[model samples]
Target: MLSGCVLAGWLVSGLPALAAFKLCNQSYDVLNIAIAQPGPEQAAADDFVTRGWWRVAPNQCATLVREPLKTRFLYVFATDVFGKEALSGAIPLCVGTRRFVIERQGDCLLRGFLDARFLEVDTTDQSDWTVFVSPRPS
Candidate 1:
């Protein structure tokens, strides 16, 4: 099963707003989650807006994107408390040694970031979306 929570609000009073994108942790173990999307302002020049280290307890959820889902592609990298990576696949992205929000990806060494494997998620051009982190069957 998957559990998630979403929040939406306006930047100004008396104005409609966009729904947020959420990530739900359906797995039994707690997860440290990372999210990447296009930068709000800088993405026109940069490629991505990367943020990480959102701790999601089991059966709970976290808001990854607080604004309306603008991009079709989202990236995620997750790990458990014991340092076990909680994702599959070999798609690599730039990550930092600690919690970070990098303006872009690529040139990890020259840019002083670590390379991590992020699974790609296609949102299908929805205004809002949820990623359910289900348990890995044993």
Candidate 2:
């Protein structure tokens, strides 16, 4: 089952904001996050690009993707500093022990990576999006 992490999205108001994908850590502990999306050559290879290991402090936000959002769906997986699963979902994705940029999914162990289940976040075609990771309820 997925943790009680909350995910919310909204457009930045006021001045024009740069298009990007961001995650906010509202939990009491630091979080390690990873994200996956359709790769640039997805249409040709039907693959996904996953990257991760962003250490986000409590109450802080991190920009996972610094460019314009291209896809409507993004997969995310997060764990606390203790290495306990904090947020996850039904979709399986490949992740690494440290900072990594994996080009494809499946056969993670064979490829020298770990397999993780990531929560799917639908951006609804927004240009910029931020996912708020709230603390799991007591």
Candidate 3:
């Protein structure tokens, strides 16, 4: 009987560590961010596969691991009044509710809250985005 109680205590203590969560909010309004890594997990080490994991309205407080369909890994975009291409000059990058694009890949949960953003991406293919995070900007 004492062993059973001790075992329960150990299990309860580990629950806190497993319940941790996080969000990634770059701006006040919602913004889409895709943490992508080129290559396929199923493919062999010698080969490569281009894939992306995306999330709509990824907040600074986001840390929960979502499924493949829930998150994306491709080019996730946020638009102002200009639409998805609003990233052309940064001037139109308004804040507020906006549309979202999602792409599924092996239970969407691309990596985690990366500590950085400035990356030298070869391209920004806005093809994987289908889900609209919002209607439009005000």
Best by TM-score: 2
**TM-score result, candidate 2:** 0.91
Ranking by TM-score: 2, 1, 3
TM-scores for all candidates: the values are 0.77, 0.91, 0.26
RMSD of each predicted structure: 6.2, 2.1, 17.2
Worst 10 residues of 3 by lDDT: 1-10
lDDT of 1 by residue, 1-138 (tens): 222222222234475645777878878888888877766674354477778889999889788888777778777888788867886345667777678988767777788887778777777777777777887655
Model 1 segments more than 4 A misplaced: 1-18, 40-46
Q: Mind giving the per-residue lDDT tens digits that candidate 3 earns over 65-96? A: 33322222322222322233212221111122
- What's the lDDT for all of these models? 0.73, 0.86, 0.26
lDDT for residue 28 in candidate 1, whole number 0-100: 87
Q: After superposition, how far is residue 81 of candidate 3 from its true place, in Å?
A: 7.8
Query: RMSD to the native, candidate 1?
Result: 6.2
Worst 10 residues of 1 by lDDT: 1-10
Worst 10 residues of 2 by lDDT: 1-10
lDDT for residue 24 in candidate 2, whole number 0-100:
92
Error of 2 at 71 (Å): 0.5
Residue 15 local lDDT, model 3: 39
Candidate 2 off by > 4 Å:
44-46
Candidate no. 1 TM-score: 0.77
Clashing pairs in model 2, backbone N/Cα/C closer than 3 A: none
